[model samples]
Target chain A: SQKIEQNSEALNIQEGKTATLTCNYTNYSPAYLQWYRQDPGRGPVFLLLIRENEKEKRKERLKVTFDTTLKQSLFHITASQPADSATYLCALETNNAGNMLTFGGGTRLMVKP
Target chain B: DVKVTQSSRYLVKRTGEKVFLECVQDMDHENMFWYRQDPGLGLRLIYFSYDVKMKEKGDIPEGYSVSREKKERFSLILESASTNQTSMYLCASGILYEQYFGPGTRLTVT
Candidate 1:
């Protein structure tokens, strides 16, 4: 069976530092990959999406890199702030489910002031 | 704003009772989904609807049933609520698979 794995441990970082999160998969190659931000007790909000053909995508202070060769995607948040503290999720889809994403367990991020 | 709304923010029901969790989306999206989030399990899909009066089974559908009568609404039914069914239920809508989620309903079966 296919599996998606994210950093299970919480990531602690300074308010102004960069936070990097990792998502890895085994036995599956999806057509597209996505990232979402989920605050405590709130549904996830869509972030940037990178297709299999794309190497990198950027939005504001966030950047995502998808490397099919490594079977992984890396989500980067630069100039992280206290408000950026939350659990980040990454999903993968075959493109047929209209973006049906197989998500990881998510990595909780806490930005220290 | 494009939004998905669940019928309740929190619910408590007795075991063996029939429970209903409703979801309505304003976006008129072609696809709607039901998911339950647990502490370490991440998000697990329970069911989904592609169109009105149409449905599909997701990874976890054993204890749940769904209803889609109109384009903007989807409901989840727990025929006999059980203690193990206690979890956060989420509703989502989207086109072509990039789903947007509702705030979620935290259900507790006692």
Candidate 2:
């Protein structure tokens, strides 16, 4: 069985500061990893995704780094704002498997002014 | 843009009632999935469909069933809704890579 864990604790940071989120996995070799943002009472929206062979990927203010050796992926948001306060989740999946995605518990980010 | 639309935002049903949760995707995706989101337990996969009329069980499919008579629609059914089933139900469509999720449906079984 595959297991995925994220920073279960809520990350509280001051507005305009960068917030870093971590995702770790064990027992599975995922070919691709993804990140999503979910607001309260809403479904998750896709943010970024990187393959196992890729080291880093970035989009606008968000940057993601993947280390296959460590089986970890880091998501970073620069100059975070109040609107960025939400639950961010990481997903793990393999190419051999169908399009099934396994998600971690997610880390709640709270950006306060 | 791809859009996944869940039938309802919130639903309240009693125990033993048959519940139907509907989802539709405009992207003509080959994969569709249903998952339950609970606090602490994270998201648990309940069922998935590879194509129209093709279904597969997931990790938590014991109490749930699914239907996909059309390519654009997938439905999750609870034969006997239980109180334990009260949680957020999410539907998603995938394109062999990333998945696009609907707005989610909060179901409460009283």
Candidate 3:
């Protein structure tokens, strides 16, 4: 069976510092991966998507790296602010699964002032 | 911007009652999905529709069913609600890859 794992523990970081989150998978090869932001009591909002062929992608102060060989993806938020606090989710879809998205448990991030 | 809307933000239902959660997307996407979110469990797909009247079972479809009579609307039906069915329900619409999510409905079965 395929499994997606994200750090279940909350990540606390000082404001203006970089926050790094990790996502790992096992027993599956995904064609694409995605990141989403979820505030408390709200649905997730799409943030970024990285294809298997893409090594890195960036938007504003955020960046993502995908290492297919390691079966891991790293999400980075640079110059983070208090407003950047939220739970971040990682999702992926394999070609054999008919493009259905599988999401991780998510890692809650708290940016301290 | 793409918009997906769920019928209710919160709901309370009694066990054994029939419950319906509705979702509508304005983007005219080809795919719609239903998912449930529980603490530490992540998002579990309940069902999905590729087109009107076309449906597929996701990983967790045992206690739920779905209806897609129109392109913009998808409904999840709980035939006989149970306490274990209480959770946050989310609906999403997308094309080939990116998906837009609704605010979600928090259903509580008592």
Candidate 4:
């Protein structure tokens, strides 16, 4: 069976530290992967997207690494702040269409001050 | 900025009642999707539409039906709302990879 997995447990880190989250999948070859941030009672907001050809992508404080061989993606937040605490989700394109995505369960990160 | 809007932030319905959830996007995106988010199940796709009047069943579309009569509007219909259907419903629209999402509607079926 095809499955996307994320750590359901909440990750706690001190402010100004680096936080890393993992997403693993089975039985799927995705063309690209996306990461989103979602707060309580709100919909997810797009953060970054990495294609299979790319190994790493970065935005101001966020970085994402994709490993197709291991079917895993890592999301890292540097100099994390309390305001950065939220549930982060990893999604994979299900087909060549690029519109359909399968999302992981999401991992919550808590950056304490 | 791309914006997607949902009709309600919260809703309550009785069992066996017919329910309709509406979503509209200001961006002229060709692809629109409806998904239900649960506690442990994550986000499950209910339905999606690539163009006006064209719809496709998603991973979990058993009791839910969808309509896309207009390019900017997509609707999800529950023929008979069930208790198990209580969940957060999300709507999104995008041209290809990056999707903009609505605020989401929390529906509670008693």
Candidate 5:
């Protein structure tokens, strides 16, 4: 079975600093990877998607990088604010999986002011 | 904006009781999914439907079943709910790749 791992510890950073979160996977080659943000007691909201062929994708102050060779994806939030505090999850889909996505445990990010 | 709505925000059920969690979407998406979220386990897919009257078992489907009679509505049924089934349940609708999720239902079975 494919396994996805993220930083189990919560990340605390000063507001306006860059927050980086890591997601590592094993035993699977995904065609595309996705990022989502989830606040307390709320469902996850879609953030960004990066394909295997694409190395980097950015939206607003958010950026995601996928490295198939390393089997890892990095999610970055630049110029972060206190509002950016949430649990960030990474999901991926392998070949022929269609819309089925395997998700990581997620890393909690707290941007302190 | 796409909207997915679940029947409840919180629910409490007893062991050996049958439970139903309903989800509705307004985006007319063809795919609907049911998932349970745990503290360290992330979101585990229980079942998914591609079209009307179609369903597929997901990673954790042993104690759950799903119904997709209409395109916009999907229901997750817990047959003889157990204490271990206590968790947050989420419903999602997707078109191609990106999925829109509902505000989850927190279910507690005692």
Candidate 6:
């Protein structure tokens, strides 16, 4: 069976600082890794996706890095704001039919102003 | 933008009662998924349909069943709900890579 792990502890950081969250997986090789932002009582919204061949991807204020060798992915929010406080989840494409995904126990980030 | 809508935002049911969760998508996507989110377990896939009448069991499908009679609608069924079945249920629709999720349905089974 495959396993995904994220920091179960909540990460607290000051606003405008950078928040880094980690996701590690074992026993499975994924083709694509993705990050999602989930607010309390809301469904997760897509953040970014990186292929196994890619090293890093960046959006406006979000960056995601994939390290296949380490079976890990790092999600970063630079210049974080209080509104960025939410649970961040990492998912790996199961590479099977229908493009199913396996998600890690997300790390909740609390950005303080 | 793709829109996914679930029938309920919150639900309460008793043990051994039959429960149904409905999801509809306007994107006409071919893939629809049902997942349950728990406190520490993250999001676990219960079932997914690739096309009409084609369903696949996901990681956790033991206590759940799904119906996809039409291309745009998918339903998750709990034949006999249990207390342990209480969780946040989410529906998603996607073509291949990116998925659009609906406002989750918080289900509480007592």
Work out the TM-score per prediction: 0.98, 0.97, 0.98, 0.99, 0.98, 0.98
True contacts kept of 2: 0.84
DockQ top scorer: 4
Q: Which pairs in model 3 have colliding backbones?
A: none
Q: Residue by residue across B1-110, what tens digits does model 2's lDDT show?
A: 99999999999999999999999999899999999999998988899888899998888998899999999999999999999999999999998878899999999999
Highest TM-score among the candidates is held by which one?
Answer: 4
Could you list the iRMS of every candidate? Answer: 1.3, 1.0, 1.2, 0.6, 0.6, 1.2
Winner of 4 and 6 under lDDT: 4
What lDDT tens digits, residue by residue, belong to model 6 across residues A1-113? 78999999999999999999999999978889989989999999989999989999999999999999999999999999999999999998886652788889899999999
Question: How would you encode candidate 5's per-residue C-alpha lDDT over B47-66 as one tens digit per residue?
Answer: 99999999999999999999
Residue-wise C-alpha lDDT for candidate 3, range B36-94, written one tens digit per residue: 99997999999999999999998899989999999999999999999999999999999
Off by over 4 Å in 6: none
Residue-level lDDT tens digits of model 5 in A1-113? 78999999999999999999999999988889999999999999999999999999999999999999999999999999999999999998853856988889999999999
**What proportion of the real contacts between chains A and B does each prediction keep?**
0.76, 0.84, 0.70, 0.84, 0.73, 0.81
Task: Kindly report which residue pairs in candidate 6 clash with one another.
Answer: none
Question: What TM-score describes the B chain of model 5?
Answer: 0.99
Q: How many residue-pair clashes does candidate 3 contain? A: 0
**Candidate 5: residue B66 Cα off by (Å):** 0.6
How far in Å is the alpha carbon of A52 misplaced in model 2? 0.5
Cα lDDT of model 2 by residue, A43-87, tens digit: 899999898899999999999999989999999999999999999
Q: What is the lDDT of candidate 4?
A: 0.96
Q: After best superposition, candidate 3 residue A58: deviation in angstroms?
A: 0.6
Error of 1 at B24 (Å): 0.4
Clashing pairs in 4: none
Give DockQ per model, in order. 0.77, 0.83, 0.76, 0.90, 0.85, 0.80
Worst 10 residues of 2 chain B by lDDT: B94-103
